[model samples]
Structures are given as C-alpha cells and as structure tokens.
Target: MTSLDDLPLRDDLRGLTPYGAPQAPLPVALNVNENTHPVPDDVAAQILDDVAAALREVNRYPDREFTRLREGFAAYLGHGLRPEQIWAGNGSNEVLQHVLQAFAGPGRTAFGFAPTYSMYPLLSQGTGARWIAGTRDDDFRITAEDAAAQVAVADPDVVFLCAPNNPTGTPLGLDVIEAVYEVARGVVIVDEAYQEFAPKAAPSALTLLEGRPRLAVSRTMSKAFAFAGARVGYLAADPVFIDALRLVRLPYHLSALTQAAATAALRNSATMLRMVDEIVVQRDRITAGLAELGYLPHESWSNFVLFGGVDDPRATWQALYDRGVLIRDVGIPGHLRVSAGTEAETTAFLDAMASVGSAA
Candidate 1:
C-alpha cells in the first residue's frame, strides 16, 4: 500500500495530536471560551447587507492594506492604542505567528507561563524556536516582578503573558504588567484575548506601549465579537513592529467579505459591550457558585474558571462528558478548565461536579 508519509508535514508536528474542539449535542454547552450571545438577527442581517455590497468587488483582489478593518477594530476597542498601530490577520493566532516569525527563530527562545493559551508552545515549536514554560506558584499568580525576573533569568527573545489568562482565568493586573515591562530585556507580548470579560482591576497591557517599544497587545473578534468563524483578530503594537507584521503576513490575507462583516459588527460597538457586561456577570456568578459547591475554581477576569485539586483529572473529565457536557481538560496535575455558558449551563456543570466529586 502507498503511504502518505512523504507529504510535507513539519518534522516537529509529527507527534502532536490534532486540535479538535469537542462539540456535544446539548442545550447548555460551555467548552470553548465563546461569548454566550450570538450576533442579534438584525445585526447579522445588516452585516450581510454590508458584505454583499462589498462582494461585488470580489472579482478584484481584496484590499491588501486592510485599512477599513484596522480602523474599525481600533474604534471598536476604543483603546488609547492607535488604529495606525494595529495589524489584522486571519486570527490573533496568525498575528501571533507573525510576531514569532519576526522575533523568534532557530537559536532564539520564546518563554511563556505554564497553563497559557495552548497555541504559544505549538507556534514556538513550529517556528523552530525553543519553548520555555515557567512554573507558576500555587495560587496561579505571578507578579510583573516575578515575570520580569523570569525574563532576566531565562533571557528569552520574546515573552507571552495571557492576561485574564486562558484555562486558569487569573487576571494579570496593571501593576504586575508594569513591573514586567520595566524589567523586560526583550519583547513582551500581552495577549488580552479575554480582556472584554476582565474585571476593571485588571488593566490592559496596551497602556504600556508608549514606554515599551518591544510590546504587543493582541485582541480577537472570536471571543467578544462572536466572530470565531469569521477569523478576524488583530494586535496593537509600536508602528515599527506593526510594519514588520505587515511585511510578514501574506498579502490580502483577509477576504473582502470578512472585512465588511467585521466592520459592520464594529460599527455597532454598543451591542458587543452590552454582551461583555452580561458575560462578566455570568463568569463571576459561576465562580462564586463553584466555590459554594466545594470545588475551588479561580476567581477569573475572563469568561471561564479553572477547577483544580482533583484526584484523577482524567476520570473527572470523562464523567462530565458522559453526562453530555464538554469541557477542556488541560495542563498538569489536578486541574480542568471549563468555560462559562448561560446560568443554566453553569448550574448543570456544578451539579455534574457534585455527582462525581469522587474522581475515581
């Protein structure tokens, strides 16, 4: 029999498990960290109208510059970070790759905290940069001083900090990020993929861009904007780095339809903000409810909570799945991360936890 082994897959990726999101047949689902709200029917229709208007020009190539979407995203985020300084791509994941390609390569080091967004390590390996993960203390907390110390000690070429961190949902506050910025000898990336759900006490790292030329803040339409399938995300960095991203990304990466849909959603920023307020409420409510149930989940500034200190993490994950709930089973000893859904969904998960408190 002929083998497909000759096909060009990266040598390093040979041992990796394919990433498949577990979608179950259930009314109340909470797996991926997605905003519970779908785009309002009216809003979606309006976006289609806008996209259709632009579709007429599909005969020509898309705007390689992506000017409209870049400006629209900055206005929607309304960050002090300038639109001119923002760069868009297929997803924040792609934008991250651009950063890696620009700064990390063979003989370079990319350091990130353990239990971060899973993509960081994969990208590091794929880009031929060595990946270094620092272990966090018991509370899943790291001061900027602590991170800064790691940078000085490890001497990584680039660093990734996931604020309101993935899986753990621990928010990195401004003071901590500030200290890291002050001490970082290399480029520091603050990945705020879940920032819309972060508590006010957790300020975005974008505020530090002026003083830190080696800083980049990544954002995504996938989470708060409910555009995961749209594949639109961006990063705000110093103009020099943003230009580097422009030079690195394939020309006209974002299709015309995507630009129009993204722009339409951004114009109605109030809708996204309203959804964000609702999601934050749900996240807090779920965290508190989990605590009351004898499970110690992190008090998150993101859209999910991490349940830890379990005995057999594998068995616990299986029980939840058997009961028709799907959650991300991640990281080392005694922990599993689940996202926040509706109030009912959160309750169902808690009830399931009570059902299988014994992770045997």
Candidate 2:
C-alpha cells in the first residue's frame, strides 16, 4: 500500500486537503447546496433524446468548440451576449480553473474576500498561484470602498467574487463588483452559481461585461437547472478573454453527451428554472423556521440558508443526522448551512431542528 508521502507530489499540495462535502444516503439530504428538486420529466425526456442522438456520432470527437452549447448559453444569459463571449467546462470549478491557469500561476497571486467560495483558494493553489484572502464587511457582505482598497493593495493576477456568497449566503452588490474591477489590474471573476435563485429584479454581473474585458461572470447548471449530475458550468466575458481559456483547456474537454444534455437543458430553461421559485419559498420558510427556533438566519438571496447562534454546530449537525436529515457544518464556529429542499424535506429538517432545542 502506498501513501501520499511515498509519491512525488508537488510541494505546494503536500499537506492540502481536497475540497468536498460529506456524502451520505440520509433520507433528507440537504448538504452541498444542490437543487433538491428533480428535473421536470418533459425536460428529462428531451435531454435523454438529445444524448441518444449524440451517441450516433460518439465515435467522433465532440464538437471541439461546443458551438451550439455556447450559443444556447448566450441565448439563456441574454445581456445581448454572443456565442464568442461564452466559455464552459465540466463545472464552474473547471471554468474558474481555466481562468486561473490562463492568468495566475506560479509566482502570480489570486485574491478573494475571505469566507467566500471554498473552491476559489483551492483552484488558485491547484494552478500554482498564491491565494490571498481579503476581509469582508462585518456580516459577510462586501462594500465597494473596502473591496476597492483590498484589491488595490493585493494587486493579484486573478480575483474571485462569489455573488450571494456560499457558507454565509450574503449577497454581493454591483457597486462592489464595479469597485473591484476599477481597482484590480487582473481578471476579476464573479461566480454566480446561485444567481438564478436570487430576486428576479437584481441585475447580474453580466450587465457589466461590456467594455470590461477583465471581468468574467460564471454560472452553473448544478443549482437552479437541477443538472448537477450533468456537470455543466459556463461564463460570459469579452471574446478575447474567452479566447485566453482556449490556451489552457484540454482538447475535447466536454463530451458530446454533456454538450447535448446541457444544450437541451438550456433550450428548456423556462421549465428547468420553474423549480427556483418553489425553492425560494422553501428557503424563506427555513429562515422563518430558524428564527422561530431562536437561531439567527442570515438574509439569503440563494436557495439555502446559513444560520448562526449554534452552541455546537457539530452536535446539531449530528443530531439532525441521527434523525436522518443532513445539513452542512460549513466551519463557521457558530453557524451551519442547509439547502432548501422539497417542501416535505424542508419540513422534516425544521421538525428535526425543533426537536434539537434552541442552541442560541
């Protein structure tokens, strides 16, 4: 049996742990922030048909450009985006990895507000770039002034901004994004993986893409589209910025089946996103439910809630687990996060929380 110590691993990765959430077969699984709803049957049928059709040419390499999928993404995103401005990969993680590989590696640095997405630092280190963690406002929010000051100081080659941040579910204002872009001389990425679940009237970072060649807004199908298993993520940026990713991507990185499935999902974007409205309702319900239980539920624009005031997050997490309901202990000393699931699943989680008593 060989251990990691016996292998010639990169010095930077020697003591680093891989990123992942605990996976269990618990009955009411709400960890990992996945869309807990199933894909609509009609959409699933269409995707299956598209995948089957693609199988006919499986012997050949997939469309190297994934042209139709890019067009589909442009259409879905619709800030007058064109296909040339779109790029995608296995998941948003890969999409961000491409950005780091193209802009930040060995000797260069990547920066993000601390307690943002866990993957930002991981992706930076994996690309051989140094990770610089900056501070956020008191309640996990980012202010324009603070953001500008931090970026000006770090002057990193890459910056990641998680809109409606994970772990704490705090929303990011466009002012802060514009502020960071104005100060940072490097590529600035706005990860909007949970954007579809945000308030409908909120403007996306895509709205700021024009003329800001260094800014990129990335999105994922894993949340609102119920396509997590399909693993499709994409971003909108200047055509030239999209071009830079081409230098680092592996040939035929996306398979024909994946391209087909994601395109089909995009074509039925309306139906695929119907689940978001219901998920929002559940997210609010969880917030209200937590408040009634004497916990501090943060304001969330995404399909999950991160609450504080837990005396022991691990104990509450385990108690919920024992009752067959699972949530995330996102490493915030007094906080835990849980995804908004189907109505019944949400009820189960709340009921389990009530039984655990108030840890506030």
Candidate 3:
C-alpha cells in the first residue's frame, strides 16, 4: 500500500484532514444537519419513475447544460430568475468551489466569519486562495458595520456569508449581507442551505439581487427537499456570474440520474417539502428542551440547535452516544449541535440529554 507520505501530494494538503462528521450509525442520528424525514412515498415514487426514465438514456451523456434542471430551479426560486441566471453542481460545496475557481486564485483572498461553515476556508484554500477567518460578536452574530469594516480592511477577492449558519445555527441579517457586498471588491456568496427551515418572516438575501452583479445566493435540496442523497445544490445569481461558473465547472458535471431525480423532486416540491414546518416544530422543541435542561441554546433559524454551558462537551457527547443518541461536538468550547430529527428520534435525544444531566 502506498502511504500518503510516499505519494506526491499537494504540499498545502499534506497534513490537512478531510472534512466530515462522525457517522457512527447510532439509533438517534442528529449530527450532520440532514433532514431526518425520509422522502415521502409519493415523492419517492415520482423520483423512481423519473430516474428509471433517465436510465433508458444512460448510454447518452447527460444534458451538458442541465437545461431542464436549470429551468426547474428557476421556477422554484420564483424571484424573476431565468435559467441563464441559475447554476448547479453535485453539492453546494462544489458550487462554491466553482465560484472560487472563477473569481479567486493564487494571489486572491476569500474571507468568512469564524465558526460559520467549516468548509468555506477549506474550499478557498483548495482554490489556492488566501483564506481569512473573520470574527463575530459573543453571540456568534455579525453586524453590518463589522462586516463592512472587515471587507474594507481585508480587501478580499471573495466573501462568504452563511445565512442560518452551521455549527452555530444563527441567521445573518440582510443588512450585513448588503453591507459586505457594498465594500467587497470581489464576489459575495451567500449560502442559504437551510433557508427553507428558517422562520417565515426571515428575509433572504435573494431579495437583494436586483442591482448587485457580484452577489450570488446558493441553496441546497439536501435539507428541506429531503434530497440529500440526490446531491443537487444550486445558485441564483446574475447571468454574467452564472456564465463564469460555466468556464470552471467540469463538462457534464451533473449526472443524468442526479438531474432526473432532482428535477422530479423539484416538480413535486410541495410534496417533498411538507415536512419542513414539522421539522421546525421539532427544532423549537429541542431548543426549549435544551433550555429546560439548564443549557444556553442559541437562537436558531435553521433545523439544528447549538447550545452551551456543558461542563464537558466531549463527555456529554459521549454520554449521549452511550445511550444511542449521536450529536455533534462542533469543537466550540462548552457547546454542541444536534439536528432536528423525527419526533421519536427527537424524543430519544432529549431523553438521553436528560439522562446525562447536561446542566451548567
């Protein structure tokens, strides 16, 4: 077996670990912020039929442009978007990488607020762009002033804003997003992977796309659409920006099966997404349960909750795991994050937490 050290590898990636959370396959799995609900039977049936149809054309290459998928995505977004203004990839990570490859390179830089999505910096570094980890306030919130100030100081070639951020599960204000765009000399990517789970009144940066050519808002079907296994993530941006991504993405990047499944899922969007409100209900239940257990839960607009005040987060995590409940120890001191699972799974997690006595 050739060891990694024996093989020729990029010097920058020599000692870096790959990105992933633990997948222990416990009874109550709530670690990765996945939609716990299975694809509803009706939607699953449609997806199977669509995929079977595509299988008949497996010998042919997928639509190089994924034309119908783009059209379906545009209709789903419904903010006057056109197919030309939409782009997609296997996942949002790939979409972000495409954006970075087109805009940021060896001499350029990308900046993101710390404790946001862990993958932002990794993606930037992979593109050979300098990565700047900016700071947020004590509550893990970024204000418009702080964002603009950071952009003005760093002068980065790209900025990433993870709305309803992961690990912390806090939503960024539209003001902060627009403020960063005003000051950023390069592209601004707003990641809205969990937007569907956010409160009904929460504003999306999608509304700010009118005159901002540098702005891009990315979304995923993994969470709300219950299509994580389908690997379809997309972005809505100016036609110019979308065209630039075409230059960097691989030819026929999305597979025919993926395109068929994702398109079918979007066609039945209402049926596939019916669990969103229920998930939100479970998220609130988890938040309230955490508070009752004497933990300080962050205000979350996403499906997961990040809470603090654990004497030993690792030990508490282990305790929960011992009871067959697997949550995420996101490396935040005294903090842990758990995704909203099905009602039974949620109850199991809460029971495990109660058993562990995770009070401050």
On TM-score, the leading prediction is: 2
Query: Where does candidate 1 stray beyond 4 Å?
Result: 1-10, 357-360
Compared with the true structure, model 2 gives a TM-score of: 0.99
lDDT of each residue in 1-360, candidate 2, tens digit only = 999999999999999999978999999999989998999999999999999999999999999899999999999999899999999999999999999999999999999998888989999999999999999767898889989999999999998999989877888999999999999999999999999988999999999999999999999999999988999999999999999999999999999999999999999999988999999999999999999999999999998999999999999999999999999998988999999999999999999999999765
lDDT of 3 by residue, 1-360 (tens): 888999898887788788888999788899999998999888889889999999999999999999999999999988888899899999888999999999997889999999889898889889899899899999999999988998899999999999988879898999999899999999999999999998888888889998999999999999999878778899999999988999999999999999999999999988877899999999999999999999999999999999999889999999999999999999999899999989998899999999988595
**How many collisions between residues are there in candidate 1?**
0
Model 2 clash tally, residue pairs: 0
Each prediction's RMSD over C-alphas, in Å, is 2.2, 0.8, 1.0
* Candidate 3 TM-score over all chains jointly: 0.98
Preferred candidate (lDDT higher): 2 or 3: 2
Clashes of each: 0, 0, 0
Between prediction 2 and prediction 3, which has the larger TM-score?
2
Worst-scoring 10-residue span by lDDT in model 1: 1-10
Q: Rank the candidates by lDDT, best first.
A: 2, 3, 1
TM-score of each: 0.93, 0.99, 0.98
For residues 284-359, could you state the per-residue lDDT of candidate 1 as single tens digits? 7777766776667777878888877677778888888888777877855787788887767777887888787633
Off by over 4 Å in 3: none
